[model samples]
Target chain A: MKRMKKALERVAETGFFLCAAAAVLALALIVVFLVAKGVPAASKIGLWPFISGTVWQPSAEKFGIAPMIAASLLSTLGAAVAGGLIGLACALLLAEVAPRALAGMMRPLIHLLAGIPSVVYGFFGLMAVVPLITQWFGGTGNSLLAVIVILSAMILPTMVSLAETALRAVPAAYREGSLALGATKMQTMLRVTLPAAKSGVLNAFVLSTGRAIGETMAVILVAGNRAALPSSILDPVRPLTANIALELSYASGLHEEALYLTGVVLLLFIVGINIASHLALRGGKGGR
Target chain B: MRKILDALGYILLWLCGALSIAFLAVILIYVLSRGIPGVNWQFLSTVYKPGLGLTGIRQIIWGTLGIAGLTLAIAVPVGVFAAIYMAEYAKRGRVLTAIRFCVESLAGIPSILYGLFGYTFFVMQCAFGFSLLSSALTLAIMVLPVIIRATEEALFTVPVSYREGSLALGAGKLTTLMRVVLPSAVPGILSAIILSMGRVMGETAAVYYTAGTMAKAPQTVFSSTRSLAVHLYLLVKEGLGAGEAFATATVLIVIIVGLNALASWIARRMSQRFTGGAKT
Candidate 1:
């Protein structure tokens, strides 16, 4: 019986280890497959031209991603700035001001916001926000600005939740000390709590930007998907994510490979963002 | 001046909070108001009409469930066992760090990249082709981090004393884990499963390429299928049916909200149980 139990333990341990190893294996597979598919195409196109060339007409065999890259960076910057500020303010309200009951009631709304599928957001954006843009700003309704608005709204929940956690984590002593120094409540929050939670909030902002950068369906629906350089925020542009989703269905040969290369670029951006967010998190821990 | 600025500051905070809430309310109210009117029994129960994009969503619903169910089947056991390994068995060291890093990296990855990987690896390389099996396999990998994190957290909260007591009473480690640890972690695992289901159901880009946008009911796991989210995307993108699009959007929102609420409720209940148990 003891030997049987020992054998069983050994079997369970091996099985559990394989399960854990599966995660590492999955990540490794994703990186390997993406690079293997994407790199040869990158080399053929000459890495610089593929990244910085002017046009992206896949049918004509031209594959440039500069415009898409610019669109992604600009829209994410806009959305992150807009979403991050509003989200930070909302976090402050939730953490420092609102009654516990009200905050509790409000959280589900944020979760709902987060939970709603991007396609639904895209549909809503197309039906509602696009029309408003056309009526007011007078473009094809689908433009970079519409992408920013939709993405900012899409990213709000993530920003608010992360920032709120950071704000709540600020030691109460900081606020108390500021109040004891005769600072007003507003002044204390602004000067004491906000500063103390700065790294965490920054972490939240970086992560939200990553989300904005990665978002695909909603951006595709609203951004008009014109793969070209844009002179203004009102101009329609296709981001890198949109580039892959829009074309990968029918694309074959080198064009398909180019799309995989697009995914590689996107993965690199995500990795960079993750590293930055991780560092920001570590910075918060070090400060504390 | 200081007093006035302070008043403004208070107003700003309230305004921002109100604004965030308003965004949620607007999206919900807008989709429901526009969509609820268009939905009918025929739309919900009958097979979808291809190309027309107007008649029904019975197939889409089934496809969504199939993908989500299969994904959970693939993900949950592997995730739970992985969490068990990390929480109950594994020691602190480089293996733990490597696993943690991979999990975090996976979590941060965008879905479209997963879609790309799914297309290249599952569809082309593995020859699963564009089908339910491909999408499920892709999404299973995508949601592993979520399940592992939640399950590990739940395992951590199972109370060391319970394990100690079982072992002291001569229960073997494997037996204690299976009989004692898992029972308490069910709520967390359930919540995690529900969360991943919601994610898989809502996923569009990753599923779209892996599971081709065929409007017919999926005949088997090997058959190409379009999920509800992807169906909605096609409806809007192709300008197929505006009213139906709205209706589909509403259905998706309703289900997603329900799932999110359920997960949160389970999470709340689990936390309460653990805290209460600790007190006793």
Candidate 2:
């Protein structure tokens, strides 16, 4: 009986270990497959030209990602500028000044915002936002401006929640001390509390930017999938993610490898953002 | 002068707060007001109609639920066991720290990367070829971090005293984890799974890449299928049925909101139960 019990225990332990190993295995498979499959294409295309070339014509053998990279950066920065302002303000209201009942209602609103699907957001942009832009500002309406607006809305929840958490983590003493020194309520929040929570708020910005940059399908539907340099916000631009999603189905040989190479660029963007956010989180921890 | 600035500050701050609420309200009202009228028995029950883009969507709903269900089946057991190993069985050391670091990094990865990997490995390399099983596996990988983190947290809160009491009563560690720790942590685990379910249901690009966009029920796990998310994407991208897009959006939003609310409610009730249990 004792031997049988020991055997059962051994089997359980092995099962648990294998399950834990599966996570590490997944991480391994992703990196290896991406690098192995992506690097050859980048090397074949010449890393410099592939990254900095002016056009991205796969059938014509021209594989440039400069425009896609630009669109991604522009949209991310635009969304950050827009979402950051609105989200920080909402965070301040939630963490500092709003009445308890109002804040309570607002909290779930933020959660609901987070829960709403990205495609649904895209559908709204397609039906509502695109029309509004075309009617008001002109152009075909599927442009960088629309992508930024939708991305800003999509990213708002993450920004607000993380920023609020950071704002709340500001030591109570900081706000009280500022108030006692004859500062007004707004002064206490803007000058004292927000400054103290700077790292956390900055972390929120970095993470939200990551989200905006990584978003694909929503942008695809709204951002006119024109693989051209966007001269202005009104001109439609194709980001790297949208580029891959639009073409990978039919791409083969060199064309296919180029898409994987595009994935490599995107992976680098995401990894950089993750590291920055992680460091920012660590910085916040140290400050607290 | 300072008072005027202060008042202006209050106005701006309140506007920002009110702005978020307004956005949420507008999105909900906009989708529902236009969508509810469009929804009917035929729309919800019919299969794909390519020309009109008017899908009955019964098959699409099944694909979403089936894929998400498969994800939970694989992820929950693996996540729970992994959490068990990390929290209870493993000793504190470099291995534990390494695993924790990997988990955190995995959480930071964007979903689209998962799509590329899913397309490359599952669809092309493994020859799953846009099948339900392939996308399910990819989604399971996508949501693993959520499950592991939540399960680990739940296990951490199980109270060391309970472990000690079980061990003293001559139950083995495995038995104690299964019999005692898991029972208490079930509510938290359920919330995590439900939240992940909502996320998987809402996912578009990854599933689009892994599961080919054919909005019909799979005859087998290996057959290709499209989820409601991808269906919505196609509907808009093709300009098929603008009105139907609203209807699909309404259904998607309702399910997602309901799932999230249920998860949060469960979490709240679980916390109350713990507090109440402690008192007793």
Candidate 3:
């Protein structure tokens, strides 16, 4: 009986170890695979021209991701700027001014908003937003401006939640101290609490930018996907994600690798953002 | 005067809140209006048709469930075990810190990147070839961080007394974890599963590469299939089927909202149970 029990214990322990090892191994495998495929593709293309060239014609064997990358940066920046300011203001309200009852009501609403699927957001953009843009700007329904508007709506919840958490984490004593020194509530928030929560606000920005950069479905629907450089926000444009998702089906050989390379560039950009935010937050902690 | 600025700030705050709320409402109303009115039994029951009778979302729904189930099966156990290892066994050293950093970084990587990796590794290199298994494995990796973080939080909240009591009873470390810790942390684990389900249902980018957008039921685990998400994407992208696409979106939205509500409820119940048990 003792020996049987011991054997059972051994099996359980081994099972536990296998499961834990598999979790880490899965992550490592993904990173290794992306780098392996992406590096070779990048080497063949020579990183600069591949990223900077304007035209992306797989049929003619000329591929350049510059325009897509530009649209991505432009729309992501637009969304962040629009969404971030509004989200920060809402967070301040929730943290400082709103009644307890109102705050409680708003909390779950925000969560639900956050929980709404990106596909639904995409459908909304396609059905309602794009038409509005076309009516106003007078071109194809799908434009970079449409992408910006929809993305701003999509990223609101993430920004609000992170910003609110950071605002709440600001020590009450700091606010009290500022008030005691004859500063107005607005002054205290802008000068004292905001600076103190700068890291958190920055973290929120990083998270929002990450979402904007990787946004696929909604942008794909609205970005008009015209492959050429977008002359204006009113014109149709293709971001990196839209390019890949729209073209992955018929892409053969080098065309396929080029798409994969676009994915690699996106991955590297996001990973860089993540690492920068981590270091920034860590530095903030060390300073205090 | 300060009074005027205070008033302006308050007004601005409410305006922001109202705008956010309006955006949410518009999305819900638009999707529901377009999707719900179109949903019929035939639509739900039939398989994919290009421009016709029933926009069979049934197969897509089933495929979504299967992939989600497979992901839960793979991710939940590994995540729970890793959480246990971190909370109960691992020391707070450089190795543990590195592990934590990796977990956070994993969570931060975009879904599209995961799709890329899935395409290269699972679909092509491993030669799973855009099957259900490949997509499920890809999703498992995607949701692992959520599960680990939730499980770790739950386990951390299980007070030191439980471990002491188990040790006093002469139970081994592993036994204590299995019998005492996990039962108490079951609610947290359930919430993690619920959250992951919500993600799997809504996800588009990651599964697209790993799971081919074929509108057919799988004959086996290795067979290719289209999930509801990919199904909706194809419908909209092709522009051949608007009515069907809206109906599919409505069904997907209902399921997603239901799952989100369920997760929130489960999380609340679990935390309540923990507090209630602790008081006793």
Q: Return the top candidate by TM-score.
A: 1
Q: What is the lDDT of residue B22 in candidate 1?
A: 95
Which scores greater on TM-score, model 1 or model 3?
1
Q: Give the per-residue lDDT of model 1 (tens digit) for B1-280.
A: 9999999998998998899999888888998999999888988998877545446999889889888999999999999999999998899999999998999999999999999999988998999999989999999999999999999999998999999999999999999999999999999999999999999999999999899888767789899998999999999999988888999998998898899889988998898897874632
Tell me, what's the RMSD of every candidate?
1.4, 1.9, 2.1
Candidate 2 DockQ score?
0.75
Candidate 3 TM-score on chain B = 0.96
Which residue pairs collide in model 3, if any? B46-B56
TM-score of chain B of each: 0.97, 0.95, 0.96
User: For model 2, how does the per-residue alpha-carbon lDDT over B1-280 read when each residue is reduced to its tens digit?
Assistant: 9999989988998998888888888889998999998788988888777576546788898888888888889888998888888988889998888788777777766777888899999998999999898898999988898999999888887888988999999998788988999999999999999999999999999999898887888788898888888888888888888788888888888898999999999888787776775632
Q: What lDDT score goes with residue A51 in model 1?
A: 92
| Model 3 residue A124 distance off true place after TM-score fit, in angstroms | 1.0
Residue A7, candidate 1: C-alpha displacement in angstroms = 0.8
Compose the digit string of candidate 3's lDDT tens values, residues A191-285.
89988998888889888999999989878888888888888889888888888878876787778888888988888788888977887688668
Q: Per-residue alpha-carbon lDDT of model 2 for A32-61, expressed as tens digits?
A: 898888888888899999989978889798
Provide the lowest-lDDT 10-residue window in model 3 chain A: A13-22
- The DockQ figures for the candidates are 0.90, 0.75, 0.63
By the TM-score metric, which is better: model 1 or model 2? 1
Cα misplacement distance, residue B253 of candidate 2 (Å): 1.1
